[model samples]
Target chain A: MEEEAKAKPRNPSGPRLCCVCNTRRAALKRPKTLDQICRECFYEVFEEEIHQVIVENQLFSPGERIAIGASGGKGEHGLLSINLYFCSVEDSTVLAYVLSTLNRRHHYGLDLFLLSVDEGITGYRDDSLETVKRNEIQYGLPLKVVSYKDLYGWTMDEIVKMIGLKNNCTFCGVFRRQALDRGAAMLKVDKVATGHNADDIAETVLLNILRGDIARLGRCTAITTGEDGPIPRCKPFKHLFSKCISRFCSGVHQGFGKNKVVSSLTIRNCGLQKPRAILDIIKSGEDFRISTSTKMPEQGTCERCGYISSQAIDRATKVIIPGWKWCKACVLLEGLNKGLPKMGIGRSRGLNNDRKDAKGNDNAAKSIESKQCGTLDF
Target chain B: MQLTLEFGGGLELLCDSVKIHKVSVEPQNGAEMLTMKDLLTWVRTNLIKERPEMFMKGDTVRPGVLVLVNDCDWELSGQLNTTLEDKDVVVFISTLHGG
Candidate 1:
């Protein structure tokens, strides 16, 4: 099938026959092995390696429904707010292609669906959503889109308008956490698969370490997370590189350095010079042990939405909702809806003023607007 | 030398959102042949509309970008040292974006 490409006249560097097959012209130099391999061999090994990861990790069982978190926003560092555009179209498209192919070839018996969260970022999400829609038809997998407006009654565009860009990413990151879970639940999927590759995980490790986020630091390297939640998520590409995934899909776009917290570009530079550094970072992160005395946030269900949350209900919010625990998303939405906008962002603050507003004003509309934040609406 | 340049995966955004460009370039200093290094200088000066740093670092493209010449990975070729021929197709894709 690739004979036509072989027939083309050789360029100045000449045709290097594939190292693995000793036939067919080498098309790429792999970062992992530095092997010059042909297109066919590259595709085979790429798929096989991912298949191996799935099998070894036991990411799925037969007849389980899986949703691909078809957003480019997975496993991002610092400026996660705009990661929605981080290889948004290509990675998701490739994930859909490879997962569907593996499911059939390996008889994984998985019902795969593309689940996307529409943050309503106007030009950004609008374009990627179209690509995912195309992938739905191309892969013959069903797609379910959950939007911010439908869930929280406010789009990112509207949130930005009110809160401005100062802390909008905080709002975005928190919202997407719940949005993906809600989307998966709507599809009745057993697990969710994200296009998070080794590079993203490595960067996340470095980012978490830098910020002293010991909790996420420990869990960021896991192949799958949120096991106790309503829907768990896995990363099939966790062992893969971002370059291979984008190249497999046929193109790559520049992810400009946007995170002020840390430059992911610098980490990418390390990967380029030494590809093994990515895996090494993940290994180091995995080996990290938290002392017994260190208080890790306990995972419990959000009383409002019934989703898993690490945060306990604060006294102020408890007074308002009366013993109902609010998850991060609900807290952020409660802030947005109540016009406080800073309710659960950054460090936990005294909602003393919050209680005062609810008690003095007796604003039933604002205080009782918890209906706009829960996952049950879907 | 006449060359066909194509950008994708967001490099097109750097070049005024135009993905393909047909351009003619001449070797600087009256050199006998045009190499990719010269072509890159030409592209940086004439094509890229914004964020030149995103498109290039040092004398070559930024680390994460992939370069293909005549549909073959540039690494198979000589990369920046590879000489350009008439109507040769050179593709630059930035693999740095999402995931």
Candidate 2:
């Protein structure tokens, strides 16, 4: 093993030099630029790019309390949170390590906390949460875990049992969004940062366009979303690529810094979508402009939960349930509790007609259309 | 040549949940040195027990999967053409899991 470690430069004839520094041997080929750079130069450029994005977009303000939405599952491709703390150490490791170092190097006086949502998936989330716990200790950041069972009285395992594999992701997705917001609220943070890279945003853009969601398509590309909501959300990695994030996470896992065990998984096959298509979708989303004359849903607070929404009730059903206007989340919970899984689902009018006997409102109901499973609703 | 292969980022799930494997790989009949392409083919045939599609696409690994040879990103080397020596450590990590 020692010999293998020392024998990294197999070709001794002419060593490949870092394109940027042009002195040290190249460590990795950058995916974005395909440039072969030494580790030091890569560290400089990578951090510099992220710093530029944060500064240009004004992602954060000094002294703001930020909650990092750390899922602790897939480190890079999955929702991983980047927290800024002050540590005066000069480390060349990736984001997490660099951010910790920057805490001291740059004195970014930000109170960062890790807020994780436990979806209560037995084998999957259970295993990943252990990694999140390790990270909590490793980074010396306090962690708050909000479970689906605790928040919604249903775990993903239970939801899957009731709804089967077909639309279980819908429940999980909607619940997760609310859970993250609630978790952030519990943390009392000013802003929430999620580890959503450029690819995820591009994918959201494509899905929105495909679904004809002009409102979401217009706002999906924004670095920070839901600013008007209870807790504002930001994506520091919005301009960053998934490949770069994965490389950085993998580097940290491979013992690049003070982290001991490989507590995070960095590799993820984010579907079969080509990189070119992802970039194009993001570009198209940026260029898209919704005309003012077009009819768009007006934003309003849900009567039941007081959450911000473009629609008064669940977006799927136009019929206002006699007394209360519940948000999509409350409506989904009502369906789950009332043993009517079809409520607030596809073609809400048909389902509403069947349930009219319960409420006795015979008004014409329009189908509000439901989003597909595994797609971002925002 | 003998090599130590480490699978991570849920890649072990495809290979009976085994993280590490020490195996011997021989170059093709006329070839003198073993390149990553040969090792990848050998791994696909010998190591990956299921979901070979998740690990390999076309000739190389799926776009999201990362390969490191001797603790260095394979891209620094010639990727598929990266030559391997005796007792080298190659890591395959799939970044395709839930976040």
Q: Against the true structure, what is each candidate's TM-score?
A: 0.86, 0.82
Give the fraction of reference interface contacts each candidate recovers: 0.38, 0.29
Worst 10 residues of 2 chain A by lDDT: A82-91
Q: Write candidate 2's Cα lDDT for B1-46 as tens digits.
A: 8899988767787788888899999998789999999999999999
lDDT of each: 0.73, 0.64
- Model 2 lDDT at residue A360: 31
**Model 2 TM-score, 2 decimals:** 0.82
Clashes of each: 3, 14
Candidate number of the best TM-score: 1
Candidate 2: where is the Cα deviation over 4 Å?
Answer: A1-13, A72-98, A254-280, A309-312, A318-320, A347-378
Top model by lDDT, which number?
1
Q: What is the TM-score of chain B in candidate 1?
A: 0.96
TM-score of 1: 0.86
For model 1, residues A318-368, the per-residue Cα lDDT tens digits are 645777677767877888889988666544323323343434433432232
Candidate 1 residue B53 Cα shift, in angstroms, is 1.6
